[model samples]
Target: MSRDEVLVSTDWAEQNLNTDGVVFAEVDEDTTAYDNGHIPGAVKLDWRNELQDHVRRDFVDRTGFSELLSAKGIGNDDTVILYGGNNNWFAAYAYWYFKLYGHSDVRLLDGGRKKWELDGRELTKEEPSRSATKYVAQEPDRSIRAFRDEVVDAIDNQNLVDVRSPDEFSGKLVAPAHLPQESAQRGGHIPSAINVPWSKAANEDGTFKSDDELRKIYGEAGLDDSKDTIAYCRIGERSSHTWFVLRELLGHSNVKNYDGSWTEYGSLVGVPIENPSEQQEA
Candidate 1:
């Protein structure tokens, strides 16, 4: 999908919140903040909270995922728009999940809450009500997803892009402080995977940078759109944003998101981690 086709602006949403067949989902993982205020007519869902059952290190619990989407008034053909407090962080993951379940016509709100609040847009304190609907999940496109088994196969077959901070990629750290360290389960990135942190795709204000800038950044990291790229970060959140850029924005046809990401891969039966100095000292 083209960048223009996949991202809607806050201005557009402000004008069309109640448009027919268009639904706004505010995937603001922070419930307290969402309760205080959110886009008027927007529905809220926490990526993890709505999940029914996730095996340690997996993205979504399949049967449970279908049920959650069905209960949220989301259907296969609806035009779904997503946003959140963070610069499309959880929003991107939500988008990926919906797409995985065969939902077409999904888009992310560009700039997200930062841009909305910056524009002095009005927000609502009322919580959105859930509406039940029927949804059909199609066969998952395995190419756009990754599992522990595929990851091992990818070690020599494709380019694995570790979209985490340098420290985390180097195995110096496991988890972000807000989450438990034990949640990481293991400590490193896929072997030979290039390190290109997800923050490289956005600016301090949470809005994405210009296309020229993004192109240069990805190019410098040896990430070319022509190659098959698989991206992963802790729990698959950050990498989803990168996946958006590479797949939706840059139009890389072979881009995939390793939803299992570091948490799953690290804790797998046994995967080796390479320290930063170990690479340098080599």
Candidate 2:
């Protein structure tokens, strides 16, 4: 897919703020950021409470997803424009989730809230109101998602991109430094996986780098475009950004985001692990 197909600029978003069949939703790591201030006419999607299953360690089922969009007044035919803080980290995750449920026209706001704010655009505390719709959702798309077994099988065969910080990949930290350093039974990236932190794909303004720059970044890191690829991080959110880069922007045909990621993989039994921190200690 082309960049324009999957991403919309801040200018485009500003112009389409009131356009019919276009919905703007902000999804952030700090779910409360929306309450503080958000783009006019945009809605808030709490990633923790709205996007995830309360009873299980998985995403909300298809029915729940349908209910969510219905409650948010997001119809199946609407074009979803997702944006958020931390360089659209959770927004990209939501984009992947939306695609998983077969939403055809979802796109990320290029540069997200960060760039918008940096550009001195207007933000509002007011929320929009709209009547609900019967938002039907399709079954989850397995092609763009990876499970634990598939991850293990791809260890030596596919392009396993560990999109975590150098510290996390080397087992020095289990999570991002800003967040609490707690997650997984152990730390370290999957064996044979290349370390390509998701932040590398973004510019200082949170906008993604040009297509040529992105290609060179991954190409230098040994990513083979012909092979299928899987990207994972602590909890899969950051990796989703990279997944968007590789699949949607770069147009790599076969790439999946392993949402189970390190939180699931590091805690599993009988799975091979390579802890560089431990090796250094030895």
Candidate 3:
């Protein structure tokens, strides 16, 4: 399909699961979910296995990313549909990873596995077939990602976003994972970040909120729809989902996800981390 022809409904995906040029991917951090069951014709891939390099705090190692995509029969031209057993949480993160790596013809399965299964869709236990394919890495859209240095500089004069829980943003609780190991050498947010949890873009069930509601929520957080915005979370996964919602769903013109997120930002040793709670209104 084309970039303009992105998202495919679960029904459309169900009908086209086995079609050529259509790649069905199951992205979950947990391998057991895929082992238990997955969409028919869907291939299982751990977020770390196919999406990120475990050793690298930021993203997939370039060479490893290429090899992983090729091993899964995913090529540059493939119209890939990604979903996860857990409400497409990891799938949305995978979608952003593919886009960052320059695969433009990719989309998330709306409502993901939970919705699909709730609608009585078909699932499979055995893995799907695969054929090797090649992908020529295209120049990445730097606007959708940020590195340590860039984030440090942006802290001085840019709209940084903390896509974590309000408590984390307030420094009330430390990160859940990456204990004692900071990804960005810092312990707080980029000096001026707005704390709007990535999950805020979606409802309790993982369905995204309406455009109007998104606008209101973001607006309330001091995010100008007309300005450039940078979002970050534990390790870029949650932030990527927010990036998608902001850039694609809300029609934001300039949005970037700091893929290094707090993990990379917090581990950088001297980068200042701001706790928004300290400045809360009386």
- lDDT (tens digit, per residue) of candidate 2 on 123-193: 99998897899999999999999999999999889999999999999999999999898899989989999
TM-scores for the candidates: 0.89, 0.98, 0.86
**Consecutive 10-residue window with the lowest summed lDDT within model 3:** 177-186
- Residue-level lDDT for 121 in candidate 1: 94
Between prediction 1 and prediction 2, the one with superior TM-score is 2
User: Lowest summed lDDT over 10 consecutive residues: which window, candidate 2?
Assistant: 28-37
lDDT of 3 by residue, 116-226 (tens): 877887777988878888866666667677777877787747777888877677765557443564334345567888888877787665666777898798889898655
Ordering by lDDT: 2, 1, 3
Q: Candidate 2, TM-score vs. the true structure?
A: 0.98
- The global C-alpha lDDT for each of the candidates, from Candidate 1 onward, is 0.79, 0.95, 0.75
lDDT of 1 by residue, 51-135 (tens): 4244653555566667777888777778989888767888998888777777789999888888889889998998766578877
Off by over 4 Å in 3: 1-4, 54-58, 176-187, 276-282
